[model samples]
Target: MDLTPYVETLRRELAVAAEAGGDDARELAERLTAPLESAARLTMLNVLSAAADEITRELAPGSVDVRLRGLDPDFVVTPPPADSGAATEPAGSVEPPRAPAESDEGGTARVNLRLPAHLKARTEEAAAREGLSVNAWLVRAVSAAVDAGGTQPRTAEKARTVGQSFTGWVR
Candidate 1:
């Protein structure tokens, strides 16, 4: 998870490459290494993030996330949900859920959500616990809230005929 080692290796390689060019090249490499260290780390993080997104898509419903802890990037993986019938049924007997046929009903749109760092971390943890990607979790949550007309619990209505049964004989 520590990116320090990788950055250090890159710096060393750069220095070694410069060594062949002469003293001036070596001095330039040394000066640039300090400034380039941050850029190198950022590029590494980007690559890791992209790789995680690709893996997440392949996994679908499950997820792989690259989280940053200080200067390190940590990977968090959530495995696909296990089918209840799989253990009881023979291999290849249970069919995987089919992807919804291409639909024009409504397409997905990206929304840029900015949350406090702590809240973001909590959301990620919750998604991981449910074995879902953060996007999927957020979508489901938003849908439910919209469908229910909000997050508050609905008030129960008073019964109109409580214990009031009338027994009548037809005339």
Candidate 2:
């Protein structure tokens, strides 16, 4: 399902909440609008699924019992018990394994790019011809270019610290 409407609703709600915090907060929310829209567009389904998974893990460590309001009446997902000879780790102890750096496993990170309209249209056509999603097609093209040593050398710079950003959802 297209989630643009839902995202717009969320953004409107955010603006309303910020209004309650007075002018400064409202201005900040205005500044955040573009980034928020971009994020929602990019990570629509993944964000929702990840949140549900996290909630299940927190509530029932080794098992999940989720029920969608109008979908499934019995949709339980139970993991193997620790003592059932399953390779189980403690809840929230170990981080999940990372895929190889260049592997096209999925969108582990989001990168925004700006291309000319003509270039974008051509790229979409090329992607369609190759029977690949636009993202996968772009990834493949970039990988080929990198492999062919087509990238310019970059000057080294000192790494800088970054802070976390959060969006809280309360019941």
Q: Name the top TM-score candidate.
A: 1
Give lDDT tens digits, candidate 2, residues 1-171: 456687789899999999999999999999998888867755655555566455443433223333444322233554322343224534433221111243455433558999999999988886565444465556556654466474433323422222221111122
Q: lDDT for model 1, please.
A: 0.70
lDDT (C-alpha, whole model) for all candidates: 0.70, 0.54
Q: Which lDDT value does model 2 have at 133? A: 45
Clash number for candidate 2: 0
lDDT string for model 1 (24-122, tens) is: 999999999999999999999989988887676567566688989988999988776666545665453424232222246653345899999999998
- Candidate 2: lDDT of 41? 58
Candidate 1 vs. true structure, TM-score: 0.60
lDDT value, residue 144 of candidate 1: 50
Best by lDDT: 1
Give the range of the ten consecutive residues with the poorest summed lDDT in model 2. Answer: 161-170
Clashing pairs in 2: none
